[model samples]
Target: MENKSKPKYKLILDAAVEVIAENGYHHSQVSKIAKKAGVADGTIYLYFKNKEDILVSLFEEKMGQFVSKIKDEIEQIDEADQKLYKLIEMHFQQLSEDPDLAIVTQLELRQSNKRLRLKINEVLKGYLTLMDDILHEGMKDGTFQDQLNVKLVRQVLFGTLDEVVTNWVMKEQRYNLVKQAKEVHYLIYNGLRKHN
Candidate 1:
């Protein structure tokens, strides 16, 4: 594998996001990605084994940065509720800022085969675990309901954000996605709060 720390690796990955977003996963070719990256086609092979590897690596690299940023932002907040709100807000904000990435992640990547899907899921675990950490913190601090099921709540929370973003992408992003973060946070926060 090529050294991931190299600038060319990131170039190819970013280019893959663009190519795949425009041409789709099945139609996106290494040559196209390489051209978009301004690298020779052989350069991609040095970094990735195949097109499938590129897709998986793209998800891993991007999602790693995604989760890391969210984690860093949320770590400064003392309240779990605010942390969760930041999570939702950042999720919408990041995707909204990069329409190509939103299209690649929310649409193109989903079209991959089952094996690739599973690999993508593996990369998602870090983000899911971050959510779980927030949920557990809320429960421990008496913010969220004590009876909350962490796993199920995590799934619901992820699904809510995922579906909302997917819908926004599907709708051609005519509306501002980040604008909905407040209501989404409100609904989720109210649902998870401890009852009086």
Candidate 2:
């Protein structure tokens, strides 16, 4: 027999994403998600404790895999520039390929209250750590300025890519996000002025 439990859980999660995206976190109801999932409301509780659990688990499930894959990729590359470019490209490519997840991740997930937001932050530390590693590697090899604040640089890198993705999502995902990765990396690492 098939492992029916797994699919049910995924269905509920997918429905939650849709409902939350359509209604915003404050207005999303378990009943709404249940209807979308084609399951009874009680079924959600079988897999998740509550709405907050649903959001937390959703992020953990998706981002855990994302961070793991990137970590593996970075391990295979020694050059900081290559690692950074790969990170940015993979991030945008993943979102661009799946518009549903992109919407859920870029917009709906952030609508949670302050407490839930803190939990999400805790989960995001892994991705930030990956950025820090790249910046540290660049500094060690003299590819980047050693005087740069690693923390600030990490924030800038992540913040800029996040803004770019958000703009793409907001614009109905009509543009090519991956195509901009080269320009983004150049601006962050080399700046725009012609070399003397």
Candidate 3:
């Protein structure tokens, strides 16, 4: 009788996160990941075509859910402020909920080589476009300041959230990230909202 091969892609990814987190991206090896996954070295190649595929798949699987949740929140809310607040809250909440993903994204993933970095950037653009829509809606409704640069403001907003989450993750996940949502939103809104 032939033995069936289990689906090990997810196992490999979870193992990859631990390996990458412990060793850093440059130092992580496929053999190490396979061993951690409890599979033979060649098994990883069957699931992921290569190392880059693994990284990109990991980003897509993780961030895809993130983008979808935020998109759903955006659909339910009418006010831009509410949407922005929800975005920050959910963003921090997700990171806090999954420390492994936080470590992978905040630490190991950024260590990808230049070409892979560009690919990761491409995946990130989809998330940023969601932010851009919120900014655009705010401007259209006269809620946001007229002089705000849409693209730059989006960068600042994402950058701030990114830094906040990274700090919380790197600090041994001791911080209350979701609780800071209001303050972070207030800081961003104070800069972008129109003066009365």
Candidate 4:
């Protein structure tokens, strides 16, 4: 198994986030990240194939943490609506709490090459799968219309959240991103609700 929490790996991951966040993805160098992590430059190659690999791994590691958190949080809630609200809240709160992460994810990640984008997308399937679970649950319980297109709804839900976060990142995060969680939940709820 890949040991993400090993001290050196964790240090390299954290240092990569800081380095990429401060320098932007293109300007970020492996040597700089190694220097920040107090490791030899070759240490990065041991964990990742290249700079692109580091960026992809950073996203995988960060998003994987949030996905795990969301899964744990969602498991406690019975209602699909409640689960969706928690999801939105956690999504916003995580990015809001870490401004550097917000920059790295929303801004720097978008500037990556095509191969990197695909790799990131592959890692993102887990988050999308989680969203699909909520949509399926809603339909099962009659909270959402049975005839609703789950794939499209997934896009709407994911796209709406992505757009909102991107806008916040672009504005330099001057306002509360997490504060929009409730309203975002409401809007998405209305869109998927059977009775709406």
By lDDT, the best candidate is 1
Query: Backbone clashes per model, in order?
Result: 0, 0, 0, 0
lDDT of each: 0.95, 0.84, 0.86, 0.91
Residue pairs with backbone overlap in model 3: none
Q: How many backbone collisions does model 3 have?
A: 0
- lDDT by residue (5-113, candidate 2, tens digit) is 5998878878887787777776888899899999998878888888888888878877888899888988999888889989998899888887777887889877778
lDDT of 3: 0.86
Worst 10 residues of 1 by lDDT: 104-113
State the lDDT at 59 in candidate 4.
91
Off by over 4 Å in 1: none
> Per-residue CA lDDT of candidate 3, range 1-196, in tens?
1112345767887788778777877778889989999999988877887777777877877788899988987799999988999999999998888787788899888777889989889889889999999999999998998778899999999999999989998789897889999999999998988898
Runs of candidate 2 exceeding 4 Å displacement: 1-5, 191-196
C-alpha lDDT of candidate 1 relative to the true structure: 0.95
Runs in model 4 lying further than 4 Å from the true structure? 1-3
Error of 2 at 162 (Å): 0.8
lDDT of model number 2: 0.84
Which RMSD values do the candidates have, in order? 0.7, 3.4, 3.4, 1.6
lDDT of 4 by residue, 58-163 (tens): 8998999989999999999999999999999999999998888988999899898888899999999999999999999999999988998899999999999999
**Cα error, candidate 1, residue 23 (Å):** 0.6
